[model samples]
Target chain A: MKLLESGVVSENRKHIISFIILAATLLLVFPLVFDIFRLNLVAKYLSLAFAAVGLVICWGHGGILSLGQGVFWGLGGYCLAAFLKLEAAVNIANEAGTDQIKALTTVGLPDFMDWNQITELPYIWYPFKSFPITLICVLIVPGIVAFIIGLAIFKRRVSGVYFAIITQALCWIMEILFVTRQGWTGGINGITDLRTCLGWDIRTQAAQYTLYFLTAGLLLAVILFSKKILSSKLGQLLVAIRDMEDRVRFSGYDVSNFKIFSFCLAAMISAVGGALFVLNVGFMSPKLVTIAPSIYMVIFCALGGRESLIGVVYGTLIVCFGRTYFSEQFPELWMFLMGGIFIVVTVACPKGLAGLFESHGAKALAFLKKFLKIENLASKDKKEVEA
Target chain B: MSSTDYALYIENLTVSFDGFKAVDDVSIYVEKGTVHVVIGPNGAGKTTLLDLVCGKTKPTAGKIKFDDYDLTTMHEQDIVQAGVGRKFQTPSIYPSLTVFENLEVSYPKGRGVWGALGFKRDQEVIDRIHEVADMIYLSDKLQTPGELLSHGQKQWLEIGMLLIADLQMILLDEPVAGMSVVERKQTADLLRKISQNRSILVIEHDMNFVREIAHRVNVMHQGKVIAEGSMETVEKNEKVIEVYLGH
Candidate 1:
């Protein structure tokens, strides 16, 4: 414990300490200081932070600035929303085949219910008839998609700015495809009218609180999980693959496998966050998959300090909470304000908000070490004289 | 297997990139436990030979047979598993990982994505890590980040990482390129100690470094091995003198 403290905590405990304090403060009663609507808004922003931390791993450490994580987030959200939407349609149906017929009609079923030949929904859609399927698809759908994507991209050695451009292209292309294709993905309107998640009635205040707390719990788990990954042997390979790939190859490692691991993990984390996001908001749409939202995800990660977990959360909260204050008054100024911060961070700080906080004391430590060296030299000289 | 039965046998090996032959029609063989150094002036394709052996680049044509197995078609990682460890011109240890962790990373099955996450190093593996670290005189820096080390220390750590793989053959590409004289001497000594029981091939631009480490030197020019013999014999060869040793 002492060794760990001297190595890690002694340098700076402020970020971790401040995070605990803020979490405690929120647990105390933002519920009392603010209304349920406001609390839900706070919950939503934190959920975004969970996803951004996932970005930090791939973009910051792995040297892959992924812009298509929004796709995973969208997948998770829609999978859950689809299952939930499917469940809604099933329960609200009066006749056996009519609801099924109406859904097909909604997709181009034909003139009348009599024309419908199929009595049952697709086999794959059957499990979604239950609430559990809705809940699990939130993670499983994105997990599968990310696994496939990671396999293809990493196998091809797509990395650096080229990888970033490809991922960003993926984000915009997916958004366009989703917007245009009304048959499969429901067009720009997206999957809406989600009344509940699992068995929880989302319309009630109790359910809202349940989701609010779930978001908080999920964020904490992801923060700890990301920290563990970044500190592990897997993390060492990821960074090695980033900084000196050719060298890593000579050292007998399969660099592609490590890249795939990081990509897949990042995808799963974002997927979970996205699912939690839709639960609190009761919506999923093509608007969520656009380049703008992907860019916003990057903005929050940059603001938070790409290297620091807590910084990402703080940056997410600041941008999201601050938006409400600016949306009504100087809506035009909001983007510019963020743009200016990005420029300053990229040019001056380069480490983001956490870097800004820790650098103050980091400089002092560097000075102290220098002073200690001189002291040690003087002591050695005195010992020689005594000898 | 007999020495004549092939530790390494390359036949009609040819490699090119964008129509330029990096390695063209190169073939060589090594007996087990032999220390062979490849030497040449700049652009002689010595590094390319090592790259081909280590599977860093694929050949356009030919066979690289190690023992009974053909190595020309193998993946870089599989070639590594087939007992070929490469140390590059620059130190390539993980700058973020401690020396022990860096060594642990290359410890055979301690790699791979799934295995790396769930498998903790066994005591035997950990002890081997210590042994390698001690051999490289990096015991003090076991807990220190590779980035925090001096240039010589990084070199030693890279070697230590390779040593933990316990391969039958090692390929070192310009291993003493960026080291101090004292560090160079130590690396020569370390290579001598390891080469007693393993087949070792090294690429060197320096005749002096090759002399210090080579049991026999093979001088390469234009992607082909031109002359092979004892250091003194190769240095005195007319072809080698006219092409590589002109300076």
Candidate 2:
């Protein structure tokens, strides 16, 4: 009881409870309840949850509204997909029987490159040939991009709606680049036919199960990592920056540097999600790296309660499930339904599902406590009369 | 006066907003370990002078030297790191943070990105926060969120934030503008206590508070300093009485 009364301890207890609940659902219940196919879908959703978590930090806490998270996500997805596709092409080349087939396969070009009739591979794609390099690229590429962007705008003190618009434009530019450079980027279809990673076939049901657990595990780790950041003084500074930017500046902090750190951190986390996404779904498409999907990612964070890490995981799950269910049942109206839900959530509960739970959850607990106290009193009175 | 004996030395400080000078040729020298108050009428650019010294507004021409550091060339945070602190006209505490957090963030350490992330709330930091809170009369409200604080409490909290930074020089812009009589008296006493070791430059309109705390006073009229002396000397000056005190 004394431990529970301590604010920090109780807050930590709540987080631990939420984490355990999420872990139980993702690791145990979902795998048992759903078949391999449905489980794969959950993996896909969890992958996107990475971006949602990043948004919780960047947008919710730091007050940096990035409308182009998809760019970082795509950066991660493409980095891994490029590596996997190169390996698959190498396997094909090794198995080629005819000289004509051998000539194309020997070049070690992705299929899209061949389709474009490019005789030589682009120098940019060389790094992807090495798996280790690809892994490093997945993390750092997004961070570097975010760093440059952050330095340019944040240092200049350009933020709020302008920053959001700039990010949206960046997403548009990436989409266009991906679509036009069909030879390099697989054009509109993106990099597909990823058969294996280091000779481990990813298409198998066993692989799918392993990938699901990996995604869940990674998501939990990301949550814990984000929690660490929020628990630190840096986290308090972020909230302080959001509320009073100038005060933070005058308090001897380089406010722009903190903002840049947050933006870069968010981008890196989203990129990790993107890499996992490619592994689960076996494709990285230009379609995913556009403004619409990027906005949807923001919606996931907003609906989940941008401030709550656990809430965002639930927000991602609920929204993704809704997307699948609606698309299946009302394919024509699903888009409208999703839009309506976002508007409703924004209007009715601006703080998202986490806010709703916080306000109502406390009241519900109090009511339960009162009911238990009354029951205990009646039982004590009966015992006394009997004695 | 030699620059070494003064904590802040402003010379030929001029800031023009599209040809109209908000502060024109304003020069004031604040001696080390003294409370210097700037008293002026509305539109007299008293606040603007503080803004120029603190790097909130850049001077079109002239030098602002704070203990050998050229404040005119420094950024806002760098100026702060150079041992100078400024409080705005309004209370600017982080509303969501507790009174303790408000002071802790201002504790001068962990001013960098990585530094803040690795900063530990050790006994030293806690002790400093409690000490500042107690000084601001918010010791009992350490855990209370800043937004819940009364207006006077918020003002004190902002002052406490600067106190925690332990800056060598402090600039205060109307620190007691909206404060009640009791709150103003507390602030006057707080200023006198804090001014023992450091230099303070305050812009205030209250004559009683000014007289109570001002070790030296500069009276400004229409973007320029008209008189400089002790409170009684400045009050007795014919020019100061004609332009400001008469109104």
Candidate 3:
């Protein structure tokens, strides 16, 4: 017998269908409706959504608000950027021919490095030359960093506002370091003018569309994976820790390991998003890895429902799109409008847009059922109302 | 010193905050398969002694051995993994989770990262949850959010959480602090029933409840064990009377 038909459709089946519909809309409907330019913009936003999703788990659910998520995102972004920059440099080196390459001395260097008067590739950028190594670093670097942070803080029982403050400070430190180390990190401008990934021209319109679909596919997979984690016994443990850490510790569970796991998982996911952001946007910069952006990442998760995974995705898209539109349209009032939304969301709707939908979604469904004249639906709702 | 005879052994455990000693020179031993109760006045450091035993609070000077392992320097979770469970003074349950989930997370099946991710609610887990729910008088309230349970039920649920795992030593701090008369009586009976195989260290103040369940009672006063014997004997001890019962 089908599980949905076993009279348990209201909870599990409804959620599955909603997730499926969301995936379809992102994968199919958006591409069909929006032009390549708009779709590409969406891909960029979706990459940011990855960070927000991490916040949904780490901050929203686990109750560990890391204001330094941008540090991980930047690490992942830089790893990919360094590889692509090297690849572009290699292509330039080959095109210049052996004699010209010798004369130029900057033939093997990325243009920014050459402009900065670097004679040889730095030791740090050497590992990024290999795609496999860069790929591994994209996930591992962030995961290890998060693990270390989780260990230091969680083990010592540092949490809540203090953890948030520390993370924010870390984000600031990363931004300053990246910006000041001009020869290594390309300074304020960041690594830009990326032409290809491996040999394929990522700059072309067709490639942008392809990357959009890839981003969409990856986002859906990540959402499904997160759903699985949230449904598992581990997810419950996280919530238990969030509610009562000491109680959980005394219950025979290693609470810090769970916290570290969640932190690393969130970091790895954000790292993936960072990689995709570089692919879609064709640039990596200190701007994206600063304290302001990190806080914005958390705001996206807050606006999406912290407890609701799908709600977080929708929240990211809405906030990102709203930011562009509001900034472009009302330039001066954008920050004010954003501040107002934050206040309203926090005070009036603490659960964000998802909470708003939940309160009225059932009524809307019932109204739809009545309008469509679906047999037995309105009657059941009416009976429930009477009761 | 022979760990086989005592499930838990503590010698000269002392914890001081600044110049003041919260738990000073407190020595205790619990025999396997017996319910040992610690009765004291409000500031007699009953909770602190339990804290020292469970590794929640580090001792300034002491040796705490559980079975054959030294626990004074171990982590709280490590101490727990060594088969010790602690219930706090107030009901410290996951309020948002259902009573079943609250117990299931502590079921000791998937204690590690991968184990928890792939943990299944098999027949054994289901059977255990049902058994524990019934034991706590929460069989009908399995689906209820833990926060919504009555004061007595929440207390029982916290104790039920401790039983979900495989534990040899259980420490309960004020297990029936705010319970009604009937709930307290029921709890006294429940403790006696659960203590058949495991060693229990309970910090309690109610003398009547202590007399009802304690196989051996220790009266503490001013961070010291004033008397230790059967409930009848300890009640008659002049020092215990002067420091605790007289008050």
Q: Which number leads on DockQ?
A: 2
Candidate 3 lDDT at B111 equals 91
Candidate 2 docking category? medium
The full ranking of all candidates by TM-score, starting with the best, is 2, 3, 1
Tens-place lDDT digits, model 1, residues B1-247: 4423766777778889899887778767776777788888888888888888888778899888876667778888878888888888877778877777788777776567777676665778777887888889887667788789998888888877778888888888788887888888998999988888788888888678788878878788887778988999998999999997987
Every model's DockQ:
0.56, 0.69, 0.61
2 versus 3: better TM-score goes to: 2
- Model 1: DockQ score: 0.56
Each candidate's interface RMSD (Å, one decimal) is 2.2, 2.3, 2.9
Q: State residue A345's C-alpha deviation in candidate 1, in Å.
A: 1.9
> Model 2 fnat?
0.92
The best candidate in terms of TM-score:
2
Using TM-score as the yardstick, the better of models 1 and 3 is 3
What ranges in model 1 sit over 4 Å off?
A1-22, A29-33, A90-124, A361-387, B1-6, B17-20
lDDT of 3 by residue, B1-247 (tens): 4755798888888889997898888888898999999999989989889888888889999899887789988888888888998999999999988888998988988999889999998879988988988888888887678889998888999999999887899999999999999999989889998999898999998889988989898888878888899999999999888888988
Taking the tens digit of each residue's C-alpha lDDT, what string does model 3 give over A323-358? 988999999999888888888887888988878878
Better of 1 and 3 by lDDT: 3
* TM-score to native of every candidate shown: 0.87, 0.95, 0.95
**Would you give the TM-score of chain B in model 3?**
0.97
Q: Tens-digit lDDT track for model 2 on B1-247?
A: 6776689998898999999998989889999899999999999998889888878899999899987899999999999999999999999999998887888888889989999999998888888888888888989888679999999999999999999999999999889989999999999999999999999999999999999999999999889989999999999999999998988
Cα deviation in Å at residue A293, candidate 1?
A: 0.9
Q: Looking at the true structure's interface, with contacts defined as alpha carbon pairs within 8 Å between chains A and B, what fraction does model 3 recover?
A: 0.81
